[model samples]
Target: MKKNQFDTKLIHEGYKTSEYHGSLTPPLFHTSTYTFPTAQHGEQSFAGERDDFIYSRLGNPTVQILEERMAALEEGEVALAFGSGMAAVSATIFSLISTGDHILCSKGIYGCTYGFLEMLENKFGIEHNFCEMDTEEEIQNLIQENTKVIFIETPINPTMKVIDIEMVVEVAKKNNITVVVDNTFCSPYLQKPLTQGCDIVLHSATKYISGHGDVVAGIVVCKAKELADRMIPIRKDIGAIMSPFDAWLLLRGLKTLAVRMDRQCENAKKVVSFLQSHPMVKEVFYPGDFKSQNYFIASKQMKKGGGVFAFTIDGTKKDTQEFINHLEMIKIAVSLGDTETLVQHPATMTHAVVPKELREKMGITDNMLRMSVGLEAWEDIVADLQQALIKSNSNTVC
Candidate 1:
């Protein structure tokens, strides 16, 4: 019943019976069109005078449960689910940005988000500033009269830059700018940005929240009911609505989020430790390391250090490729936050679209490997990395 507890809320918060037997889970309403009782009833539904499901695109019982559950977890007034993470990002930005408006965004945002923002700027006459600096003064300096939004990816992708959400929110509030945080990396289990003053929080549910690689979904959570209502039309018009089947899958995934993230963070800690001590590791970037400059800020806001960390191999690009090629257990992959461990090189993969100079400046190098520690045994993962590192050095002069 309280906001602090996640497991209990995940299982019981969203669903209640709807004119049927008290079932534990909401029934999946699979129909595209819902029949109205009478002509007056249909009219009211069509005219938005009554809150009832008219079409699957507008709303569905099963989808609503997922939305409600996510909203509750994120401490938001409402939520909107999408077919994928990009859909949520697009819908949210499209809802806010108008012609001649400007956006201030973090430089190390997800590659696709950067692309989307650029597209809007180029075509819609909107302006944007991508800054590595997230300090209040840096942000304040960038804000113009037409600045409408301040977007950030705290514990930013690839580079893992931790932004102070409260500080940024405070600055944005003074400027009448909306703040949006991409919570995909931390998920709601570890971080709730709205509680820390973010106006909206978005997640790539395909990652941690789903806890499996089988589905691709996204969710946007916000404190403003009006924003949620506005998003609904865009979601429907753009046809980014999450399928009832995907919603059901996401609901099932939510049941295990707390436990999965617990194990994930545990495994990640071990991986970070191992990487820090390894001779072939250049640097280990995880928020849990207390010695890290960002550790205190991360601890202040997030419940856990999160499950993913970026580490650069103490070698050239060729040597890094050799290590990845020799890995026994950890699979080299693009996406993360699954039941299995995933490793990727952001320079050649996720952030490849970013200009080379910008990528290097963000600390995403060709030799850098971004890992998503999974629910795997710590010892097993370590052993695999040990063997991989050994193989990477077989041809090197001692």
Candidate 2:
């Protein structure tokens, strides 16, 4: 079959109806183990001489399909699927680094990722430095002889701070460091980091990739076969493999990702515009917002501004709670990239685990709100926010 465009590829890539007796959709192979055709076949498979599924923890037909699709989507040589995003994150970190090796990462990242890195440092003797990865000079200043990996999250969680991936890649190349990017916020539909020189692109498929918010999964796409080969054993031994059921769900999600992302991006742009102009909003952090510090870099790397954005309400913590309580259409939720619009307070919700001083340094303030715009009509989303803002401000003297 001819390779089609991205939208067409979403449904057709890495799959064929003939393989499943003309079934239109990929069949879910839910069995924990696959039967070998012969005793010799089983031995060969176990000996790593045959490319066959032996166990679900090692590999599965349904999971393989999802991995192939993710690899194609990410423009990577191979992709590995995991039970959760943090599983993929931890596996990648462990696979790449050794004790005494150092990792340089962006200071503003998911709370769990921060915690995991801390755990690695405290328990395993791995060292890490978290800093503003805004410039080559800053990155160089922080790098040490032991620095082996540089990890970053673009359009960083709750802040929407876009990192310059290509620039970072250039710096990493000079230092012989591996560059890993968490592309969860801007799924492959919005950004392809590997094309810009990233070594690996990671995602929390629980969010936008699954689209419906029904599955919790993660994926790591490697630009080089060597890197992928190294990660496979780590994942297999760790037993954090994605389930056949969730893989099937992710396959279904991939079919609609193109359309879902398009509509969500449109809605997000409109929502950002409204928030930027609102009297109750102090600041809006969105890639598409021209006023954003990283707008130019975002435009270069991403096709759209994505569905998620952050903004601060002009109020105290009490007023922020009032606003959240007044929201009727948008749900107060921790996870994002769902069909229904969701909003959360980052300082108290997603990034709450981070030290208060560190959270403040990262600009995740108590009054700041992260909004994940969905496929809902933009007008309704804006109306909901407008009312919430009104209710939050009504009791205030200012």
TM-score of each: 0.97, 0.98
How much is 131 displaced in model 1, in angstroms? Answer: 1.9
Assess candidate 2 and give its TM-score to the true structure.
0.98
lDDT per residue (tens digit) for residues 172-236 in model 1: 99999999999999998898999999899999999988889889999999898988887888999
lDDT of 1 at 283: 92
Q: Write the per-residue lDDT of candidate 2 for residues 312-379, one digit (tens) a residue.
A: 88889888878889999899998888999999998988898899999999999999999999999999
Off by over 4 Å in 1: 1-4, 17-20
Alpha carbon lDDT of each predicted model:
0.89, 0.92
